[model samples]
Target chain A: MNVYLMIAVCSAVTLVPRILPLFVRTLDSLPKTIRKCMLLLPIAALGCLIFPLSLTDFSSSWYAGLVGVVAAFLSSYFRRPMIISIIISLVLTTLMLVLFP
Target chain B: MNVRRKSKAFQVLFAVAGECEFDENLIYSIAKHSHFWKNLHGKGIVLMQESTLCAKDGMKDGFPIFLGYFTTALAFGLLTRTSGLTLVQGVLISLTNYAGSGQFLMMNLYNAGSFLFEIALSVFFINSRYIFMSASLYPHLIDKKSVVKRILIGFGVTDENFAVSSLKGKMLPFPYMMGLIFTAYSGWVSGTFIGFVAGNFLPPVVQKASVITVYAMFASLLGGEVRRNAKALLVLLVSGLSNSVFILLVGIPTGFSFLLSMLLATAFACFIYTDEEVFGV
Candidate 1:
């Protein structure tokens, strides 16, 4: 497959959904239940984003990604500022890999 | 966490940024300069009316997201390089597709030597969730006169900007939204560039460790959501479980598994949680 053509194809497909909603103003007309479901999509999507993927993110280290997840889970539990928790996770995960490896 | 004042010219900051850094002197100076100072001097408190959140302000609002995206994209750049893409192609992906997960899926497919059609199909399904986000955001961009601005804003809408604006629960100006998106977009692109170019100087060990950085972001975000909303736990469980099952046992593609997990969780959440419980603003 042509790499540039593949990039174009992927970019084109990606734009369709992101840009399609701009032209359509259907939120107000939707049913209450449907609206609620639509609104809930982010959380559901977030859930899918984290699991299985996080575990598989590390190509070389098996538990490095898990360590990052755990660091994030523990540090963010107190409702800390967004960056603080992430930095903590990054530092800890990096340290784990560097030391253990 | 709301504070009400009975006196005139009383103002309260929501402290959504987790800092209640309201200085009386600063407020007075800003109020003295703003036109709303006169309208609000002897009237009741109105938060949005007093300050015009311009593009500059939006950039300020988006600073956190910018910082996060920079680090996350750095990791992405490193990962892409290791995944056998050149710096230019990695940058190309970041440039054209601002959506994170979709780009990751694209790289994965491309690396796996998947056909263009398959890559396009998977990316389409993975990114389709943005439809709901953009549709939900339609209510806020209700200004009819600025169709061009609306289109631009819609193109730039990411999860962070959308969350920040929606948390305000008001119609935001076009400049502010653009500012937020531009700041975040710059961070993402620049980070990728630096990570690919400068990241080449990073020790191989550090490069290997960087893959966990993006996951760290998602974990923290989900943690924050769980802290705020009670039912986020259930959403997390069902969606995560279903996605794991679909991908692991059923052997579906990651993109399709993601979509199914999202729908199942959304349906489950709607049936169980009330409107107020599900909607956090």
Candidate 2:
């Protein structure tokens, strides 16, 4: 396959759903049950995204990630802004990398 | 002309007009004191609304979770160049864009001359879940007025956008979706370009090391979620068990293992908590 062509086709195909809502008229009404089901999508996606990270064997990288996750949860629970939680987690992870190395 | 009668009539007219004016002022005063007016005066109200809406859309749909994806894309670009792809090829892949899984699969499938059918099947299988995801989000779309609009927006549906858009429901306006997608798309493309550039300037080890940043960010987000909902404990347990079984007993590829784990976990959760109230339904 021509890599460029493949990339183009793939990108085009992938972007379809992402950009579709921009033009569609929002549904004026939906059944209450369907609306309720929509809420589970995020939790499912998040679970998939995060589950792999914890299992990755990046040496001390896993520990660093663990620390970052703990810190983020605590900060978020305390009502700290996400940006603050993110920065603190990153800084802490980087420090762990340096200290352990 | 009876002067006394005329004076009495003028006095009655004045009294009626005064009463009407007083009632109008009283109604206006009550309206001004209402909660609707008070909310409008608060400085942070608009900002708070926008932020909450953005958070719901961006965070839920993985698209706005750009920082990790950006770092990973950059790493992929650098890796691709080392693996024999040209700089143009690397940039095009990220720019034209698909999710990381499909792209990674494509990279693995790339050879001197690969068959079209093989590649197509791989892409289809990897992306099949998106069909369900888009369907789930169909009801929440703000622009479902026409077939053309549906087809167009349907094209952008990925795990990230679907996740984000579904959670947002009606709260996510079209402009916000545009903003979220634009940011994510740009981040992926630019990150790839930077990765390609960095590939030329930096050592291989340094380029590889940058990947840890993506992992760090993912950990932060996932960790937070797990802590918040005790139910997530079941997800974690089911996922871990299935993954171990698939990897150890079945000896499947990591990608397949991860996918299987997700399916099993979701299925188990659905069965075990059938009576549990689903939030967005």
Candidate 3:
């Protein structure tokens, strides 16, 4: 694949979904079931992104990442803001890598 | 009780502020004694402050997300470089396609010499989630932004932006959204540039550790989401477990597997939560 053409193609594809909603009519009148199901998209999308994809680099420094996960969950569970949760997890991830290495 | 009236008061405050060209301290003093002040909650006050104090709040709000995106974007840039892409190409990818997973998958396909059609198909499916995100956010545009402005704003709606915007219950001002997007966009592009320029300087351990940021972010988001609702927890499990199955046993591509799992989990959630009997955990 020609690199520039591939990048353009990929970029266009991603933008299509995002830009489409601006042109389409509002979704307020959609079926109740569909709207309710749509609410789950963010959760499901987050879940889909989390598990197997996150499990990829585990064999090498899985413990470090795992430690980060625990810290992140605790931070969020305590109702901390997104930034605080991320900072806590990053710090924990770094600490785990150092301590375990 | 009346959310629309309160929101309208918010728009009027900002509009008058803009017309009069009020200073920050003046607006702050007025906001303290404003009638809407008594009726509105803490969120409304913050939205009022956003008209003048946006930069400060935006920076504060955008910083943590910036940190997360910066590290992952740096890793992405490094990946692009190693994949034989030029620094310019890597940066272009970040600028044009801010979707992190989609960009990663694109490079993977490129490296594998996958057919162009395959690349296009995977990219479309990977990013199809954005349609839902954008549609969900449309109702929150207070001013009924024009198509041109909507297109511009739509271009910047990544997962992180959607999360941030969705949580804010009011219509997002263009400037406020711009402030948020500005910080994130700069962090992402700069991080990518730095990664491309200094790929070899970072220790392998640090690079490896940075990969955890994505997982940590998602986990944290899920934690916040499920802390109150059992149904959300069920959806999370269904999506995560099903994704694992699809990837491990069924041998589906990561992008396709993720999209499929999302569909299955969302459909199941619709069924499970229909009656709202088990609404609360």
Candidate 4:
């Protein structure tokens, strides 16, 4: 694929959904079920992004990703700041790689 | 006060200050305490300060989001190099498509030799979630009547800013949304640039480990959701587990699998989730 054309196509696709609501009519009249279901999209997509994909992110050791995820979850559960959670995850992932390799 | 009185009061305040020992602060305080100033404020002329203050508040609330996007975009920058995309291409991708997972999936599918249509299809599906966010925020616009401004402000919606914006019970001023989105976007683009360039200097161990930062952000966001609604835990699990199944066992591609998994979880939510619980009404 020509990279520029591909980027254009991808960019246009992403931009439409976000900008569409402004042009269209109000969304308040949508069916309750559909609206309620839509509320689940961000949470569901976050889950889908993390599990299988995060599991495979590390090439050196699967355990690295696993450890990083655990650290991230633990910090996040405690309601520590977001940057703190990322740092904790990054540190642990790096530690795992250093020690195990 | 009417506009005439208001202007007269400002002139008197300035005149008094000019005649005095130049106590600008005293003149400002006098003008603020004047009945004319209070009357103008009462007539809804206090918007300029409040709007600027709201933008400042948005920036404060957006700081964490800025941090999250920075680290994640660093990872994205790292991935862009591995994906054989130029620095400009990577930056353009970040600028145009700020959706985190959708951007990653775009490059991944591209690297996998998927056609432009395939990339677009999957990206559209993954990013389609933003439509609902935009919809949810539409009613909160400070100036919703203008289609041109609506379209302009609509572009500022993102997952993080949406979360923040949705939490506000008041009307969302354009300046506030712009402040929030601007902070986060700068973090993303700058992080991508640094990550792409730093790839040459960073150790391999650290480079490999940075990928988890993006995942860590997603986890933190999910954590926020679960904290808000405990039942969201079920949706997260169902969506995540189903995604794994679809990709590993069923051999579905990432884009479709993600949407399918999301659908299954939303279906589950429909059965158990309450209107009050979901909408927090």
Best by lDDT: 4
lDDT, candidate 3, B1-281, per-residue tens? 23644553353333222221111122212222221333244354434323342545555556655776776676677767767889999999999888876786676556545577777876776576577667666655544557777877788787666655544544566666767667777888888898788766867665556566656767766776667555777887888899889878998876566668877887887687643322111
Tens digits of per-residue lDDT for model 1, B166-208: 4443457788888888988899898888878866787877666
Over A16-96, each residue of candidate 1 has an lDDT whose tens digit, in order, gives 676677787553245657656654565566677777777666655668778888788666667555456666777777888
- Cα deviation in Å at residue B15, candidate 2? 58
Report the C-alpha lDDT of model 2 over B1-281, residue by residue, as the tens digit. 12432443343223212211111112111222221222332443322123235433443343334654566567567657755788888887876664765665455445313455445444544554454455445544454666665664565565444443433313345545655555566667777788778778865444434333333333434444455455755765676666667655787665555555655665655554433334311
Candidate 2 CAPRI assessment class: acceptable
Better of 1 and 2 by TM-score: 1
TM-score of each: 0.70, 0.51, 0.63, 0.73
Q: DockQ (Cα-based) per candidate?
A: 0.49, 0.31, 0.46, 0.48
By the lDDT metric, which is better: model 3 or model 4?
4
Encode model 2's per-residue lDDT on A1-101: one tens digit a residue: 56766776666555543443344334313453333233333333334444444335335466765665566556644545344555566577666666664
How do all the candidates rank in terms of TM-score, highest first? 4, 1, 3, 2
Give the Å shift of residue B214 in candidate 3: 1.3
Candidate RMSDs in order: 8.0, 17.5, 9.6, 12.3
Off by over 4 Å in 3: A1-6, A26-28, A90-101, B1-87, B99-150, B157-201, B274-281
Give candidate 4 regions above 4 Å deviation: A26-28, B1-68, B105-119, B139-148, B160-184
Better candidate by TM-score, 2 or 3:
3
The predicted structure with the larger DockQ, 2 or 4, is 4
Q: Candidate 2: which stretches are off by over 4 Å?
A: A1-56, A59-94, B1-90, B98-150, B157-184, B191-209, B248-250, B272-277
- Candidate 4 chain B, run of 10 with poorest lDDT: B16-25
Model 4, global lDDT: 0.68
In model 4, state the lDDT of residue B88: 96
